[model samples]
Target chain A: MENNLKKVDIIFEDSDKCAPLKVLEKTLKRTADDIILDLIDSGLKGRGGAGFPTGLKWKFTRNETSDVKYVICNADEGEPGTFKDREILDRVPEKIFTGMAICGYVVGAKEGYIYLRGEYNFLLKGLLKKLSDFNAALKKLNVDFQIYFKSGSGAYVCGEESALFESMEGKRGEPRNKPPYPTVAGYNSKPTVINNVETLVYTTMICHMGPEKFKALGTSDSRGSKVFSVSGDTPIPGIYELELGMPLHDFVNEFGDGDTKAVQVGGASGHCVPRKKFNDTIIGFEGIPTGGSMMIFNSSRSMYNVLHDYLEFFAEESCGQCTPCRVGCQQLLKGIEAVKRGERPPAYLDDLKKLTGTMKIAAKCGLGQSVGNPFNSIIDNFREEIIY
Target chain B: MSTTEALVKELVEKNGRTRNSLMPVLQGIVQQEHFLSEEALICVAKELDLSAADVYGTASFYTFLDTVPRGKNIIRVCKTITCHMKGKDEVIKAISNALKIKVGETTHDNKFTLLSANCLGWCHKGPVMLINDEVFPELTPQKALEIVEEYAKK
Candidate 1:
């Protein structure tokens, strides 16, 4: 089974010669539309867990006729259980900058910003050194572009693109209303293309390797490789880059502890697949898509505790701008505690599920919309453990 | 002028007096003062031409920019699922016991403060804690307390 595993190291293929910068020079030779078309052919989706087509996002930003445009690399890796971006920023900071530069050239953006999370403030000095190196390289290549970094003040909601914009503008990191969308109006109301750190790195890869080779790695619906942050109960708990559409069972066979009971894909906002469903689950767009967090849980772990921890996180992390997300998170956390304490009947969970459903639809942004994912999944899968 | 007022003035001058420099200015204040004083917030608001409420709301919204004064050494223990599964509670308890204060409270000597953080992005090395800027991962209760003691002494 291990023999069939394919590992691609396009992002991590850094040499003394600076591979991504060389690729960016090659990519700059192509027309803007041609580069966007190459991305479309590659079929790469946003690695930010939303599965938005990368080419479509770029094309929209590229097509916007604006005097000012911005490219932002979302380095706010705040999602619990996800740490792949942190590694990328630490090891190959230049690759991310190169990717952002390429996006700027294609989208007609002259300025870019990387909104790095505050928890990673320690990485500021090293990343700044890399940025200066990248800027020097850009000057040498005669590219008229610049990159900047904004350190977030420890808000998880800032990971959202609009909130990131607000944070960068020196405001509370709250998400803005869509429809103008980031493509038409973003980052001081200019056309902005905000791509995830990993997504931009992958863009560099697609540009260097060509669409055909990148597409051939994963399934049709989900193309290219994904880097996963594996933790909990696994003998080897670290980052692993694998083909996008690999089955959950296969991943478990390779990384899970022998007594693995469930795997939480995509962090707290993601789903939990139990042992029985691992065979049917695939880690890609067609199955359970992830933002690169794969936390394995063994038999010794309590499902209720896992669910409780996630609820607590959501409750505290909710932006409190919307009532549904703010109140809904607290209620879900309290409701589960009530069930655990035998204060409420197990059937009362149905009402909480209905509340989560409301929060999913009624909340303004992704934070509120997706809280129901882990809430419903955990309640439905482990009713006995949660109630009894 | 008071130290708080002087610091605020310096930050405003360094980051510019525009409203768009609010967050960075606030972050700079917090970095220097460890917490944002009411005087500092008001001074920042006056310099940026914003209302005190605006400055307060923005300062309170973020987790790291504490409005209230905390201990000299802040220890943030990870409370996410990966750390929870890896017995993070024991580590939290260890720190709490060593400091003689619960989570969210400062010690009597004002030396250390213990708080639970959502995630420090060190899930792979579960059971992690961030002491100020440094990360200590894969911790046991003994190691966690020992580290706390080492900080408490300093």
Candidate 2:
């Protein structure tokens, strides 16, 4: 019964992932470096929008000072059209727990925190039972690890790695300047390793499959399988795992059973590849980020309204600490309004373009840069809709 | 009622008798009692010397802490894009239909409260529902109702 495909459904398929987790209880005696090498070889990237190499991120934490290190699983997955982590937390909480333990063991950090979103408090309602079960598994495995959950205050920016760390410290969730990069200074100024919930949850699978076997599925640029939400106009819109190099035409129609106009890869921060461009686009770096969110829009949808949602999200969620993000987000919205209301001549459109460029270059952190992505992608792909 | 003199005195005493403790005092009371009733808000305002408007603003701005009494079980289905496109609206409807109540409303038994949220940041799991902080994913309408029914029995 399709043995190769891994399924860790707590509520769905009887129990596919339980095998690897059971094997982990017996194996996993090696140090953290072995796990990192296995991760690097497997070609696993962050499931969140960033798409950073999981191995490379772990390497940075490995390189950092040993004393007072931290391992935090960034469960604060607030990106639009991204529900992969919540699924892992809810359905496969044990797998996520195992991955967190492996990370803590690899990084030699005793403490781990799952920085979950506050809206997920209701999700956590039944999870304490699972957590207790996981804790019991940890003692059984003989790993000296302790993990706790810290709920997010529902700030979208807190989804950023640094911001998640700051929020865990009980401050308002806001993105901090990088260069320290959380690998160096994170979680109360300790050397920390933060992985997206999916990234960590997948480690147990890789630990069982081995890296090269895990790498066998996807493209060279983006290895292994990715989970897609595939919402919007799709008859079978739900999560499906596909290889990274899979064709968009096939991917779109795979579950998005409809006449498609465009595919918004990588959720709100990702690009809107027009239907014509679908042939050339793959879900990876050589392609756009699958970011694990594939929202297909048909003719019925308006490009303007879609772009508006992204801009509005940024405007409302900006941390308000930095000028570029705090002010530029509002300006982008105002300019959109100005254009929509016919207040600006077509020539004024040049200013909006230039301002977006300025925000990209001068903004403080990932929030500003990420905010630029949705606007940039819309202007590039949907210029015709935007211009008139 | 949050306004009983016994509870109010305990809350104010716990927060210390300072004007600055107004928000903290109300927040403390809510944490203890699980909902900030109108009487509790008034008690906090009276004890802390802050306007009721100010107290209400602090309470409502953050969505985590509730001001009104919540149902015995709260189902916060993510209305975020990942969830929405995956039939979150339908899921909400299913919950409402089963409970015979609408979103943001409680059942007559006060056993379930249904509400929608932006994103819980776990976009990987579409059509996700959080029942009091523990999320359940990939829900069909029937499965959701069954979960709600279980909670109702509790």
Candidate 3:
């Protein structure tokens, strides 16, 4: 057996970079508007694949007039090869809870939900205990807040915001038609603001450091560092948190352990940058979202199987909603078979590419848009491996 | 919701009866046993004042917590992208040779059941062999004996 990646301390070196846990008790005095301003100034963006501005989502949700609003934490991270959220929830449980509490305050929501993924029983066990303790403290402090726990069906599709809302509402985890996103209308048709685990965790930091300091760390546009689950054929392949817009090549060598030929940023929905494009890419929203999953491929690795695995995940976890994703994912997986058999002509490849492009544009949500990424990346990068 | 007559009856037979009793019942019967027996799930549903579909839906959704009884020692072999590309077939061959069972089947002794999952979220550590969630990363045919010995000792 080969020695595996070691869990190291690359991210939290400046543990003092975070808001002190004691600050949560003081938050009861702050109003929702103040919290929103803090987040907006922080330039906080959604950490859950999309990288949409978190403060903008909150502003939209806050604009909706609903007394029965909700603040949902999309902790149901079913992204293939991603576990950065798991570590944050496991290690910094207080930050997530505090972030949720801040969301409850900012959005004027009476109720909050931490929709944890189903396989995370180990994680939930610890979180549940922390919630209990936090609740008792809150009750003593007379803070009017309540966050409930809802488990998911391990479907990667539920990672999408609207679909997660549907699951939280006790329905099948299928994507909802958008225009009125989670902000204007969400959970139970109520105005809801859904943020990623990291998004919420960072909220505490944003509030503490002030928005300008939070915005100063990463890039000119995107702000702050991101935690990524680095995987594949590498020497050290666990999670690493790096400043946004950090050079991809520097990252690959420093954290990726120098055995990478290609890299897939942003889990299943991410782009695969071949060695040729690796230097040109930066690890942020401007290029492609790292989305907590940074997967590397050594020269010895076969690209064909990687494409197949990602396509299969999309096929199974498409939430069977919106025909484009549900059917498109299946087509991509089956297309691999045709490519393997050399039955697909160059025209056939063009058709498949067109289909993926269609899914990216026309599909219901981020799940559909991101679903075609691996198919497009693999076909573009590794046609030789598919025939071999 | 709380437990019902069927639930209370089972609670007496197993755990206890009360409101908000699903988590404990799930812990007692499902997590410990690996899969909730039909009778156990029905009992849980009846106790929680919920439908069997609701119970089954809850049960099947999570990655952990199986619904049916599995073999004694669970062998979850990673068939994820990296593993597949790196000759997972060879690892599977070794697994099947050692256990004398194909993927998704249990041995005659019911001592081992092999599962082919997409990835254990550990693609970098390809061919991860988990004997009940204890990850054995970058596994090989030769390493099969280590698991064999561990199971034998157990």
DockQ of 1: 0.84
Cα RMSD to native, each candidate?
Answer: 1.5, 6.5, 5.2
Write down the TM-score of every candidate: 0.97, 0.77, 0.84
Q: How displaced is residue B57 in candidate 2, in Å?
A: 12
Q: In model 3, how large is the Cα lDDT of residue A299? A: 83
Could you tell me which 10 consecutive residues in candidate 1 chain B have the lowest summed lDDT?
Answer: B145-154
> Can you write out model 2's per-residue Cα lDDT over A90-146, one digit (the tens) per residue?
776777777777777777688888887766666665778878777777777777887
lDDT of 3 by residue, A52-170 (tens): 88888887888888779988888887677787787787787778777777777777787888888754555666788888888776677666788778776446667778777766654
Give candidate 1 misplaced runs (Cα > 4 Å): A1-4, A16-18
* Model 3 chain A poorest 10 in a row by lDDT: A1-10
Clashing residue pairs in candidate 1 are none
Alpha-carbon deviation at A169 in model 3, angstroms: 4.1
DockQ, computed on Cα atoms, for candidate 3: 0.27
Residue A284 in candidate 3, Cα distance off native in Å? 1.4
The DockQ-based order of candidates, best leading, equals 1, 3, 2
Task: Report chain A TM-scores, every model.
Answer: 0.98, 0.93, 0.92
B146 Cα displacement, candidate 1 (Å):
3.6
